[model samples]
Target: FPSAEHGLSADTEEQLRMRGCELIQAAGILLRLPQVAMATGQILFQRFYYCKSFVRHCAEMVAMACVHLASKIEEEPRRVRDVLNVFYHLKHSKGKRTQVPMPLDASYISAKAQVIKTERRVLKELGFCVHVKHPHKIIVMYLQVLECEKNTKLVQTAWNYMNDSLRTDVFLRFSAETVACACIYLSARTLQIPLPDQPPWFLLFGASEEDLREICGRILRLYSLPNVSLPSMLKEVDQCHLALDARIAKAKLAGGGLLAVGTPTLDVPSSFSPASKAGETGAHHSPIGNTLCNKNSVHVSFQKKVWKKHCSLLCFIWTPFWVSALRLTSLSVFRRSRSVSSPLRSVSPTHRQKISRRDREREKERERRRERERERGRGRRDEYSRRR
Candidate 1:
């Protein structure tokens, strides 16, 4: 079948192509391509399956293009020419080439143009399934809960660990929800903590319990594997990427929905505030029994007259009449006290002028002393120079 090519099986070449597509999709993430590109690739793989056509090109290039289109749609669009030229160089370079024959003629501009056309086809094939649910978001939520008593660095280490779990075929077998739950489960165990309850966010994907457990086990194995560094695991992922990407892309594009046909839409959590706690009434609690009390009734009503009449004398003293008068009187008293208490203000103008004149004379005397000192220094320097 390696030589045979172009057909279906229990494990078909087409299935392999789809697998290649998923790896490519994952690599696109490392390549810093937009998420839409993965979506685009997914759509393209399904379309390619329906057509059963095999072009003698780098599967990575096509997957990249699919991703590029998705990026464009998602507004994370790469420069079409850049995508083309980079892949073109990669295709022509034998050491880096993904397949037997590479398509160097697939220049950046040409690829861009091709993607533009492919985008429409992809959109049609996917039935315009534009929104994507990423595990990265779920990973963030899991980290927030897991790190409740820890710093961000601990959570970050766990998140970094979980990213490797994503590269495996587990995502294909499980929904993003289940995969996210597994990541959380593994992250908690890695930190040597009790596995946190799957946050409400995981329920958004509606994964079955059995599937989620399987996903969790695979993630745990990833944690236990010796000498399997994240970078190396990622590189291996890169090697088999095109096939993985193809599988994922095929599934996505074949979609009635991402997981199942007409799956109920999951409500996205608005934000993680104290107010977002389960069944809590907003940020502040209502005053005691106020929820049941009548607004217009005397007992619960917040009336000004009730406070004015019954409140402490301190409250009456704080009334506007007393407050304003007291303020004005305080200002008058402050002015009068200032006038009386200030010796400088009470002093006659003539006497004050005399003090100022004496201060000026003293300042002049100091300046004269400084000038005399400078002259003496100069004279001493001149005497020393003559002696030398």
Candidate 2:
């Protein structure tokens, strides 16, 4: 979805999405998350990229953020520390070098902060509509409808197709039901099983043959594509960013570094909401994305406190947005270094209730009962002393 203004070709954006979705799936497994949560995270990741480009952001960070956000949205909450730990382990487990993982030090704290910030960014871009409609369950339901539910192989194949489709824009372009139908259609054909074609089984599910074909094509196309490596992908995106930066510098030199002044800056305040419109786009339009930044400058949080001049988005006016977003107050973050903490979230804190007058009087009566008991013991001790 990278427009011509984004300067990256559609293929590059697609690769970023594919790799990000793969990361979400892998992270979900390491975090022991359910398939639905993983799918939801993948959908959120894609929805984000539909508005943001790879050039302006880090794919790995966004992938982790989506997983973190989705887990909570799905009611299976994992703490920021646990999410970061799992992601860190997975990241290091891939290499031959035995790198001792960074302890829960300043570096980890920075990464944790980055995860929270990135998660907020994703939510903001999406207008906080993180609900994901997955087709995996629908595949089983449809299989049962066609009396093929008992066919384990076919069912598994369709389910796999649905999962794979998460790496593509088919979910964004079509309904979950349509994608489910396409998955079943592809699976039936692959397994050499005949479905009811007289009325076309998909028709019963409200999907046209054309919709099935389009979706199936996307599913099949995913397998044909080569796997994307995270490191290589990062390098590629970095190269694009470098090229973008160079172009911006050249333009600034040509325009005496004043071309970006009148490009219409966005007032992305801390209270920025969907109603706070940016540019000419609608209220629900992606705020810090296509309209805000034209690739002049990006302010991203990097681990080890390494900041990259990752943007040359002249029209974006991203500094103020980053400032407001970063100035957010988090009590948990403040207390992070002051105390030991668990990685996974426990029960939410309960509020202190006001005590009733009766309950308070009962509490006072119990105290008086203890006072009488002490007085009796003192009296007995005094008598014993007299006898001695």
Candidate 3:
């Protein structure tokens, strides 16, 4: 009966993902699997949660299965039992002192069963698309292509960035090429390595500067470096979600005419008017009586004045951006529809007439210019013939 509302909070979910990434790395190290396997497993674990909630599934079991599945997919298979044993050792040895030791009774069977079950679930959630494209190969290819492979420090830093990026959701959101470009960009910036400016590097991968900038921002935000606080960012994200929910609720209420006649009585302050007190004290107090009272009238007028002033200020602040956004969106939609449909159907008759008139005038002007040029060329030919 667990719902999303009762599930993990934003901060907790991020922490759990970080833990899962750590486990994937540890398991990879313990099994002697290549870094690619670890990266693939981390991506699988992250992608699985997009389809299934973390509240319903255990993170540890899923992480182990991901690593196990990744090894098989990478053609470096590890036994399910061996993977579980590695997890068991990691938990018991590194777990906090206050943490209760995992029960030995039926633990092996349960752990192994959970790993297999979760592995199947992960595969199903991923739609059997086990092939994860990691940025490591792309990083190497980019370094070689850019002729920067000789800079061991830069290459190693970029490799570390790619590894760190897997801990975040960038792998799920962006392409391997983009992530590779972003990592390399960040690494170069960190090392003060000057890259070519005329034709930026990201363009080679068909990625724009903005795309690389966004990916790098996400990666930097994930690292929560000295200037960036993860908790504060999470708080801001939660606030934005809450604001969006509030806007939706307000729109629903407005559309339903539930708040059309009057403002909420509960929201009006009782101290502002005696009528509000009458409504509270007298059982037979009429709803209209509150609005009829002179004191109440004055209070309502003042509230309305203040509300209008605030609305005007807000409109002044946001009008330009809102107008521009709407204009751009409408223009794009109109262009798309015009391309798909007949020109006659897309534009009104009046506008079409205006456009046709402009086109005709342009055509006439072009014809006149072409005639003038031809006449001048003939006169020049005649003069040259005379001179000859």
Q: Name the best candidate (by TM-score).
A: 2
lDDT of each: 0.55, 0.78, 0.78
Clashes of 3: 0
Candidate 3, residues 298-364, lDDT tens digits: the string is: 9999999999999999999999999999999999888767655646553566567777999999999
In model 1, the worst 10-residue window by lDDT is 1-10
lDDT at position 201, candidate 1: 38
Question: How does model 1 score by TM-score?
Answer: 0.40
1 versus 2: better lDDT goes to:
2
Q: What root-mean-square deviation over C-alphas does model 1 reach? A: 21.7
RMSD of 2: 19.6
Model 3 whole-model lDDT (C-alpha atoms): 0.78
Q: Write the per-residue lDDT of candidate 1 for residues 57-86, one digit (tens) a residue.
A: 334544655666666666676766555555
Ranking by TM-score: 2, 3, 1
